[model samples]
Target: MHERHTAKARRRRGQRLYLLIVLVLAGGLAWLQISRIHSAAGVVSGQQIAAPKEGFLAPEIQFTGLDGQPHALSEFKGHPIILNFWATWCPPCRGEMPALEAVYKAYAADGLLIIGVNQMEDSGKVSRFQEQFHLTFPIFLDKQGQAGATYRARGLPSSFFIDQKGFIRKIVVGGMNEPLIQGQVSALLGKE
Candidate 1:
């Protein structure tokens, strides 16, 4: 009986240890993405936009808007832009949408552009998601994953804050709360 009990306890411990390890690894990976520990992470192959850091020129992207019209990143150069890469299936992405929309509405008149780049999802599903969130910002389709690949958005809810000069000011890899979004936008708009 003692040996049997001991064997069961060991199995349980092993399982717990495995789970703990997984959680630690996941947290570490998230931290790396958020903190930008990997400096060379966004290397483009054969003309792909290189992974950008703070102060790097925002990538020149070619994307299709939901309106079926083509848009270029350079066209929004004079405005402060929040270029977000997300997917409908990502929980963090879904969680951040409301905050993003709120900030976009609050600063739209101030030339704040929030472009939602849906990663590899169908246009219909993305449109439905936009409607579900009551979002008014323009959503672009990264159908071939070219944009995300260039941006090297290691996490699902990544956002690149671009200043008026078209340089990336910040890169956040996790969900952002409303207040944080507000503060960031305020600063970008020179209000803070």
Candidate 2:
């Protein structure tokens, strides 16, 4: 009985030690992620656009719009544009749609363009999603995912804010809320 009790206590101690190690590792990873976000935040807040090293120019992109018309990014030049790369399946993408639409309505009158780049999804699916959400902003189909690849979007719901000069001013990845979108737009618009 005494030997059995001692073994059980040893096992418990070992389990506790293992849990402690896992927790420490998790905490370290969290800290690293937070630091990275802070660093990225600092980098994009400046006046310069944040885009891939590749030059930003007129790419002959013609994709099916929600209204079935071929659209191109060049037509929206001479205006501040918010280009969002998302998919129909991304929940975070779904969550951020309303906020994007709100901003679009509020700022469209001011030459603010909000373009949704739907990647790797069929035109049918894109149409359904757009209609369901009552999205008034123009959504371009990245059928081949070429543009998204160029941006090196690590995941879904990545966004690029382009100034009127056609320079990318900011790149936002992951999910975003209204405040975040508004703040970035305000920054690009040079508004308080």
Candidate 3:
């Protein structure tokens, strides 16, 4: 009788363990799905907002700069914008910093804004990276990867050329060269 009781208790514990494992897996999957859904979000206006792409209004992006100042894409609507998504750890991103800096310097007088959005990283590291590259343009910290995911920046050094009217004129993935960035800027400024 004692042997049977012990056997039952062992079976019950085993069943509970299996059930706990299943629940944990299910919870993890649920959280992952939710994160993906949030990443697909766009502007919350009543208009027909599209999943950020060319010829469409660039999705609203709100993030704090390394200085801890709040910023959003809507605030820069009247100026030509080069919305660049990058990270200090990405080699391609590092490779394009100088070119981006050059572009910013070349067009600052022309009202061109190169906004760098760095993916989830430490503020100090980003600041040091900026110093290393001598980047003068604005660099916003995407602490939660919201801006990066919202912009669909699957690859490093992804960039979006936004016109003064807030439309995404062009979307380029991977690294950009000086001529490519300058050409895009020229086109955004209607100089091309």
Candidate 4:
């Protein structure tokens, strides 16, 4: 009987050790994620990082717009450009279109250009969405999702705010409201 109890205790101790190891690993991973988020939030809040860390030029993107005209990112070099990657199926992307449209309307004359890069969607859907939102900004078709891949966009509604000099100033990975859009636009315009 004593040998049986000893064996059971040994097994329980082994299980406890395994559980402890798992908890420790999980805690470490969670801490790492939180740290990264805090760092990204600092960039998003425009506190520490003023520009993209890489300092590399914005990737060249050439696509046809809904108006059936060829559009290229390089062509908009003299203006502050908002390069937005979105899809019709994404709820946040849909929700944020109106805010983007309003900002585009208010600031387009100020040399602010908003380019909506649609991901692998038909012209009919994109046209309907644009009509629904009355978005006057140019909407480019990323038929093969090349633009999204070039930008390394992992989520819908990702945006890059580029300065007039054709350098990327800021990148937002999620949906943006009017104030957030305006703040980034202000920074892009050198008003900040």
Top of the candidates by lDDT: 3
Q: Which candidate model has the greater lDDT, 2 or 4?
A: 4
Candidate 1 regions exceeding 4 Å error are: 1-51
Candidate 2 lDDT over 1-192, as tens digits, reads: 999999999999999999999999999999988777555544544424434532243233445676567777778889998888899899999999999999999898889999899998888899899999999998888878887877776689988888787777677788889999999899879997
Could you tell me which residue pairs clash in candidate 4?
Answer: none
Clashes of each: 1, 2, 0, 0
How well does candidate 1 match the true structure in TM-score terms? 0.72
For residues 44-105, could you state the per-residue lDDT of candidate 4 as single tens digits?
54443233322346778777787678777888888998999999999999989999999999
lDDT of each structure?
0.86, 0.81, 0.87, 0.85
| lDDT tens digits, residue span 65-163, model 3 | 798998888888899999999998888888888999998999999999999998999899999998888889988999999988888899888999988
For all predictions, the C-alpha RMSD in Å is 13.7, 11.7, 14.3, 10.3
User: What digit string (tens of lDDT, one per residue) describes model 1 on residues 33-127?
Assistant: 89763445333111224347776778788888887788888878899999999999999999999999988888899999999999998889999
| Selected candidate, larger lDDT, 3 vs 4 | 3
**Against the true structure, what is each candidate's TM-score?**
0.72, 0.68, 0.73, 0.71
Candidate 3 runs further than 4 Å off = 1-50
Q: Pick the candidate with the highest TM-score.
A: 3
RMSD of 4: 10.3
